[model samples]
Target: MPLPEDAPELSPALDPWEGLEPSGGQGSGGGRPSKPGPGLHLVATPIGNARDITLRALDVLAAADLIVCEDTRVTSRLMQIHGLHRPLMPYHDHNAAKVRPEILARLAQGAVIALVSDAGTPLVSDPGYRLVVDAVAAGIKVTTLPGASSVLAALTLAALPTDRFLFAGFLPPKSAARRETLGELAPVRATLVFLESAQRLADMLADAAAVLGPRPAAVARELTKLFEEVRRETLDSLAAHYAAAGPPKGEVVVVIGPPTEAAGASEAEIDAALQAELAHAGPSAAAAKVAAAFNLPRRQVYARAMALKAAAP
Candidate 1:
């Protein structure tokens, strides 16, 4: 069985799941396991370390009537390592429309189907959301067996503000569109997280530096594995580092810090800003918008707005 070009450069047998007790699947002799409930079970597999899987996830995978995945071979290899010889079928973006109805039919028939991505949790960046939506509409129960998430893993490693964060998914592949999108999110006051391909990482970092300015940022690569690395630096330095080093291997996530007090504009600048927002908004509302943007006092922004309005044509 040949691995796909996109298949992870990992052997499932390595770094065996530490907390999981080896249990029954096909020949797994932990003992006869209790049957998982019928309907759809969304299972989360490890992102890097193979042993990050949970005991309950193992039980569901073992008892599942069928295991649906984005890539059959990828999931098969993982199951083989864990000694869970469950049946597997493909359910990816390309073929999801055609395959989803069949999956729903299986659930309707009381099949305990487990849906998993090639790695990590399903439905985050994957195409599992549509299936989940349809399954719920068809009155099929959908239960998620929560475990191993790259988003959470990267956020924790990044050492940024955990109080608030945004997972922005992926940027557009084209440079122009990516920059424009980044510009739209420039005013956001929380840490920004993005999932980027290893090959495009350097370019993405460069664009973030150009559009988002020099906020502190972190690049987490090959997380939870032997070579796991978390590089925390300002956006400009990260851009420069990756540009010089070329793209590193494996999965990548970028976490960027929010704007600092310097984001506040001067009085003249605030007046110019209010000119645009004031025409469409009343003074109080307009000042509130500017105040939030710069974390300034609303009274000051309101006074500025009033002065700007009285002097206007």
Candidate 2:
């Protein structure tokens, strides 16, 4: 299909997903439905596989008067594949501050606007958070068409505990800053998910290994597409493997397992360490130092140290 005037340019080779026609039920293809009020729709697009998008997302995209996305070309190509078109407006980090007011203005005029990222869900390691925040504050209706997400995909691919998981988004670029962030999350009981570039994958994994210990981990890349691969191994092994092999191409999702039970120090072990520190320094200093080292509360360590002191002869 040729690109629409409002759609972005796409590769000459149309994706296989493009072959699938947009469903009739949703506002896809046919025409916009008559919704009484205008609202902002947060649409989740496919991460790698074009067919991964939801029917509702296509309907909203087809129905919405304006569709705001990170990259017009990227979204335009996808829309072209599905044979859907709409006014594509740029709403990315670079120009978010400037374009946000315009989007709000359209919403005020009862023009339904759908926000999408280049891939995956918007505001998920992507832009659109500010727009959602502002829209909600203005009492503008907001709806989410949940669909493909790299974080959820990585979590499923990693086969880690999902009852509780934290999406830390992308780590800092600087080694020191990245390490600092990892250190803060080291003791979190929930599995951790981070979006990273293939180039920085090795370094990020190494820092995670150092700060979070040798936990079980997985690296998922090219999610939901041909040649999609997910590798599960120990943190040290992954760090070493990626470091030697260099970063792989395509998008990457790094999922690290939570601290193992064995790694969680026993009370006796902690008390011993606390006793040694308390003997060398005052209780407060000892508590502060050990707490920082273990990512624990100083108050908790201070209480433990006091208990140890009382137990002493």
Candidate 3:
């Protein structure tokens, strides 16, 4: 993605920290008084590449009274790259409860505080929900500086249906719980987006295949960085590939196409599958297997399975 010809050229001469008074605050020596007024600014950081961040985000970060982030080390590296030296504070799942009140107090005092995650947008499977809620309740101004997100990036590369979609975040680590979660999402009419761990990628895909049938999906890794990869295929095929190749390195995002009429098993096909499974397994077991294989509702499959058994001569 290149900048437009009409777009302003970004150079060292174009300072990102132009309009702001010198800071007399905590964390760092170069604390700058924010010009954006008192508010909670939710900034979106780049997911992978260092340069993917927006110009507006940089400005807000530079002008913020204090920068609250998931990890100071991670945020520090980003700040260093763009020649920014703002006061950085740690605020994540473990420390949000303790630090949120202090942040709110600052916001109340007309301090422009910028909240950001390690990457991407805040509150999208990231922290900062409670802070936003508290800020709003306290009548403090809240705003967003949206930029790069792995969810949208993967969807773009997936070539899947995008008109309607859901970002379900990460699934359960265990197989049983994960399958149950996938079963719940099996009937969704829109495409699905998920962030997954590298080690659990294979297992997650396996459960997804068992519960979602053979929907078309894509596995995207290391997005926007060198060695970025997107493997698009059926859910079952992806499961098999990961099972064989093991998990790849870096962050992962999985995009699955929505359910389709063509993907649904026919009544005859269901009956045949049920009959075959019932020959060796009990009704409950047979239904579970068939329903999972077809991505159909278990109760629906079980009812038909019982009918077939009763009608058997």
TM per candidate: 0.75, 0.74, 0.74
* lDDT order of candidates, top first: 3, 1, 2
Worst 10 residues of 3 by lDDT: 21-30
**Which model scores highest in lDDT?**
3
lDDT, each prediction: 0.85, 0.82, 0.86
lDDT, candidate 3, 1-313, per-residue tens: 4466799867878777799644443443566534777799999999999989876788788889999999999999999998999999999889888988899998899998999999899988877898899999999999998998999999988766666789999999999999999999999888899999999999999899888877778999999999999987778899999999998999999999777542646455777899999999999999899879888666556655776786589
Clashes per prediction?
2, 2, 1
- Model 2 residue 120 distance off true place after TM-score fit, in angstroms: 0.7
Report the Cα lDDT for residue 209, model 1: 87
Residue-level error in angstroms, candidate 3, position 272: 23
Give me the runs in candidate 2 sitting further than 4 Å from their true place. 1-37, 263-313
User: Residue-wise lDDT of candidate 1 within 254-312, one digit each (tens)?
Assistant: 98876545354544466667888998998889989988887866654665576567657
* CA shift of 108, model 1, Å: 0.3
Top-TM-score candidate index: 1
lDDT of 1: 0.85
